[model samples]
Target: LLVALGSGGPGAPSPSGGAGAGGKLRGSRTEQSDDQRRKVNSRERRRMHHLNQALDGLREVMPYSQGPAVRKLSKIATLLLARNYILTLSSSLQEMRRLLSDVRERHKKRGSYSLVFFGSELHGEM
Candidate 1:
């Protein structure tokens, strides 16, 4: 495999010389061992495959619609939707808890509103 390291035109040296517009040595390709290049390519492919897999997993669990007929959300959209979903769930839970607490407080107040004081003495469970 040809692996060059420099600025060149179309991975090739100019007819005049290897120097570029600035008269600097544009570039030259150094032949790399086939085995080494193959290994590097394989590693890059595998890394990208793994990244795609992770994104797919995230898409599967996201709140947005996911089906063969439906288009999957982009990376940014998926993240945003997930965040919104979590926030919505959190708000709903908080509202439910507040309502429950209010009910309990009302119940407590109902029973404790009738307090009797007898000669510098307080008689009330609340």
Candidate 2:
């Protein structure tokens, strides 16, 4: 009639506790580890809650919210998407700069700018 859920302590019915049905319930209530376990579990849950809140905050600033019902992005997806967004912005800036340079060169002088390939001479103007 004894029960031990945690601490792996063997539950042995005590003859002095009166041979009654309530003896089994009292054995589990007497373990101090149960309170400690509850405290540990509460801390873990709070930590996880904070982690999820951080993820949700990250999702709020992402650029991919085009769908009618956008779902929360996974951690990997968020990271990948952010990486791609930065790459796209960098490439766009590079292309715009290249175009601006081309325009300025064309306005200043005709056929003044030349593109040279690596390990080879300029066969013709780019």
Candidate 3:
């Protein structure tokens, strides 16, 4: 049975080792290993499909819209762009919050006439 499994039938020549049953088993295992490799490749393709789906979703919500003609971004580029975009947005929000706080502080000080203005004033007439 083992010899038949390796060579596919009786009186078939084994590819490896001698004409013994052990050599037949090795040849059969080689075929099995090839099948396992194919399975692994298929799994990798599925994983890449999921990864592409996630990337497409990300591209939809990102600040810069991807053009139809644009090629797909690499994984590293996508991740880096996302990181930098988020950081820049966070910094902008923080700056706006700080400015708002300063405005509120100025408004509070205005009631007491403690705010000072040093810039040149715009004049309608000399």
Residue 126 displacement in candidate 3 (angstroms): 41
Give candidate 2's whole-model lDDT: 0.66
TM-score of each: 0.48, 0.44, 0.55
For residues 19-38, write the lDDT of model 3, one tens digit per residue: 54533455666778889999
- Give me the displacement of residue 95 in model 3, in angstroms: 0.3
User: What C-alpha lDDT does candidate 1 achieve relative to the native structure?
Assistant: 0.67
Candidate 3 global TM-score: 0.55
- Candidates in order: C-alpha RMSD to true structure: 12.4, 10.7, 10.8
Cα lDDT, model 3, residue 90:
99
lDDT of 2 by residue, 2-119 (tens): 2442222344344444234433565554455678888999999999999888777767777884357887688778878878888999999999789867765774566444444345
Give the TM-score ranking, best first. 3, 1, 2
The alpha-carbon lDDT assigned to residue 103 of candidate 2 equals 63
User: Which digits, one per residue and each the tens of the lDDT, describe model 1 over residues 1-126?
Assistant: 232544455535545444445555533332335567888999999998998788788888876558778797877877788889889999999997897567557758766533232335343444
**lDDT ranking from best to worst?**
3, 1, 2
